[model samples]
Target chain A: MSNLFANQAPLLRTKTAPAAAALIASAGIIYGLVLCCINSLETFAVSFLAVLLAAILALWTFVRMAVKENDRGLLVTGAACMTAIIIVTVMPEGLPASFHVYRSFVAAALIIGLCVATLCSAVYRLLGSTPVAFDNSRYPILILPIVIALISYGMILFVLCLNGLPQISWQLISTPYDPANAALRGILNDILGTFMLMLLTSIISLPVGVGAGIYMSEYGGRIAGIIRFSTMLLRAMPVVVLGLAAYGVARMAYDTAWQGILAPDPTIMIGRGTFLLASAFLSLLVIPVITRATEEGLRSLPRDLREGSLAVGATEGYTLLHVLLPWSLPNILTGLLLGCAEVAGNVTVIVLLCGFGNYGVTPFTEATSLAHFIYKVMFADRSFRMSMGNYVYAVSVILLIITLGLTIVYLVLRNKFAERYRAH
Target chain B: MPATVEIKHLSVSYNGTNVVKDVSFEMPAGKVTAIIGPSGCGKTTLLRSINRLSELTKNCRVQGEIMVDGENVLKMDTVLLRRKVGMVFQQPNPFPKSIKENVLYGIKAAKIKTDHSDIVKSSLQKAVLWEELEHRLNESALNLSIGQQQRLCVARSLAITPEVILMDEPASALDPVSTLKLEESIQSMKGDVTLVIVTHNMQQAKRVADYTAFIYRGELIECNETEKIFANPDRSETRDYLEGKFS
Candidate 1:
């Protein structure tokens, strides 16, 4: 026992310097590697692309951390997306040119990253659990660097594989949107199309969902449980199954409404009646989410909320609108995002209903989505047909990026809305 | 400021069982009436019946006539009736809104067009919380201490300009400081509004009550002045319940 204290002191001290040395060396190695990559890569294509990809990934990661930090579960999901992107860079194709910039920036970032992480870890260890010494708000702004590093590290592999994954840069802003250039238009079109679809669908669903949620919560009574159960049961069936059901209904509508791709004819194929089919499909895909979310939100609202309003002589209608709906907006929006997230991936149903093979025709013929753009990109050049596999990986990144962006944006707005209306 | 609430042989039932059985009481003008009883006696039920607040209960059924401010409250439009009969809960339940908003809840809901500053100022002053909270009126009501919240609730009730205010053990959830503050406010509230409070604290009943009613097992046991109830009671049950003997 006498020897134990004396022996342990030097041993502990010795262990400390080595750990610190290892961390320093690792950061130094990353910095050196990044600068080397930046110096070697001289191409406009790969270098520029790598910068764009890295920055977007980092921004998405930062928002994901900030908005969804309410739960630890998002960490797993964030790690997975980052790791997947990393794996993409390390693959055979090599990252896009933008990777060189990303790596260079990352190497620059390592020093800042090491200091921030160490400080935060110490803060949490020393004061995080203790009461008077610290609080969540008083914690440092060090989270920013950590998010950037994780994103840069994960994107490194993608940059390597894509010939260079691009972190965001002024180049995108400088790059003109050239309508005459089909290649540029394809990328732009995918982005615009996804954004518009998501925005419209979300707007339509919010009021309808929030109102329904407030009503069912406030007034659903004994039947609310049953309404909730059936919605969950529906959710239990896969989204594709639900999407197929929408597809079938759409097909029947097309056959009934337009026989020859015009009104009053009843024999037209599914793709001809695109507008009606899309709306119906969109509604069916998202309504279940709206209904289910509202039910849970209403149930979760404390009884005192309603009672407080009612006691003040506000009728059920006023209480429901002003008090309940505003309070439940954040929760309801999360549900809407879930719906949006679910429906955004309906490539199978879209393909089947549109009757387009792999690539989408124009909206007048067969409107395709960004998700399906890879098919056209790879196959457009017969020489690149064998490497279509790369396109798969590339398009997947884009899809994930969009999904992550929408999710993060919606979540952040929801939180701000919740905070703004929080009772007073 | 004089108001009369007459409840005639009122019986309240929940899911078919009588919780308040044929209770009758007349709350005279310009006085504080306290309904004192053990847990689950008809005191709270009786108070809720007066304003038809019991209507909030899904299965609650009431067979009685409640007259307040010349309108039979039972037959009166509940939205209108509730505006006249304000209530404070056992816990301080301020809206998660600012103190100003919480105070304005009833006024805005009823769409009353009273003088804004004077209405707000007087109401807060009436509840005796104006000076302490004057600087923080825009802060969330929930941010206030529990005692201040109770007083804020009183201010909120006063803002509605009700003829009578019902409190279901208003001070029960408060610490002694808050409880005493509420009692002082209640003492100061008389002659301005009819106050009906249900409490288990017999000492609190003696503190500010002008008229006292003791309820037992969903039945009315006694009704008298505060002096008679404590010193000389007409019933043995009131004595047993008040004396620290078995209730």
Candidate 2:
């Protein structure tokens, strides 16, 4: 009798383990939803709908598993129990507190019922002549979380754009800020400052990045490995740290300039952030991106192309300039455009190097970009947040438009250039 | 016949492994010399040594002497040596430029002062590609068919007006029809430009080469007039290879 029980125990545990785990996970999800709903009814309703959709999906999975495993009785029992629970939970005319209680009870019952049905099917199969294998029907359930994540992201973007649409106007974008009158405030200075910063960053980073990339890929031997590793590390480094470093360098330069014979007044030349310093820091952030892109672009070319060029008596320098560079122009531009988008949206670098002071398009003056301005208005200033919340969203929309436009252009150009050199 | 290029005890090694070992030969001027061997027998390495292109590979060590026009190629400026001795690769490779630009590329790279159109016309005519591609001179070279691209590469090489042109299995990538056309181009270039071609096809050697050199395992086994090598006295390995007993 003891040996018979031991044999039954192994079979029972193997058959019931997966069903038990799924039951516990589903119950936990239901409990979390109930707690969230108790805190906020609106949030509860949304989470409850999500859970309902998930439950339906689980039921579909069970049905598929049952069919594939040849367990029709278990499928019918699970479907009937789920249908009854859904009907009970959706019933009206109960008090709010009782309805919550009833729903939780129904959810608990449904999970237990499904788990039992799955275990019974598994045990039945395990007791048969064939070896019992877990059903593969649950694989499709893995896509649920990804689907939810995408929908949530799209929903947030849609809500932000919808909220900001009414406040966006040509005048709001084209005019300077009027701090004295809340109704007349605009973002022209921020727009110009962002464009100026991006232009400066591009000027500082493009040539250096491309040159380093070419050298690393072509003639750089052991040193190229070091540079490539360092570039990757720099790309992952925090933007704020880079901004601080740039700030220190600019301050030192300013102090040194003040000691010179032809130095201008320290009050005007120093103490505040300058456009050049901001752009220099931004270049540090973007150079890694451009360098990597350029390296990949150069690496993608067939070795035969370079050999062909060299065999025709073209020098290495001439081959790189006329053959490699021209062929990889689109990839370089895509990298540059991506860098431009980085420059436009970056707030940490700008806030630390270029302050929120309003300035013209001069490299030596303190600049305010759209991102930094939004941060200043939303987080730093109380009065501005209360009065200009819609304006902040309007700036966000414009920033979104610019970055999205650049990304679209990058993708389109990459495809077009890729088509040009695709081997037949 | 005068020798256009001479290899004296030439050996090449990549990393630590020797690929071409102590190969010595002289390619006759104003004629075709074919190097025939099984795959990986170092035929291409021997051909590339004439223009010093093998040195471009990483960790590739070249020893001994390669002389072109009585000057050691290893001691001469590589760019200048390469200008004098051009190469066509196993695969057809054209620059992503217009057809006319592809022909003019070598002329421009050499910094020569000459009329571009005349050189373009004559180079294309020499490769026998002018009649078909003359109307499409402005089109990108990439759009040309594989055979046409191979001819364009030949034209581009000819534009440099090299004293010796080295081809490494130039027809290996082409279909039979294109192979015939390439052979005709090589035949037409005889007595104008000295040619050294590496091929595995014995029939190709018989059809176009004035001299045939058989290399086995990175060593030259025999070098003789194509007729004598094919018909009369030769080593056992050469006979075995020509009769397709073993690669």
DockQ of each: 0.42, 0.50
The numbered model that scores best in lDDT is: 2
Candidate 2 docks with a DockQ of 0.50
The alpha-carbon lDDT assigned to residue B89 of candidate 2 equals 90
Tens digits of per-residue lDDT, candidate 2, B108-171, equal: 8878999999999988888989999889999889899899999999999998888999999999
lDDT of 2 by residue, A49-106 (tens): 3444354345435434543333455447546655755564465637776566555455
Please tell me which predicted candidate would have the highest TM-score against the true structure.
Answer: 2
Name the regions of candidate 1 deviating beyond 4 angstroms: A1-185, A221-230, A237-279, A353-367, A374-392, A418-424
Off by over 4 Å in 2: A1-146, A178-184, A250-271, A381-387, A420-424, B1-3
The lowest-lDDT stretch of 10 consecutive residues in candidate 2 chain A is A8-17
State chain A's TM-score for model 1: 0.52
Which CAPRI category fits model 1?
acceptable
The local distance difference test score of each candidate is 0.64, 0.75
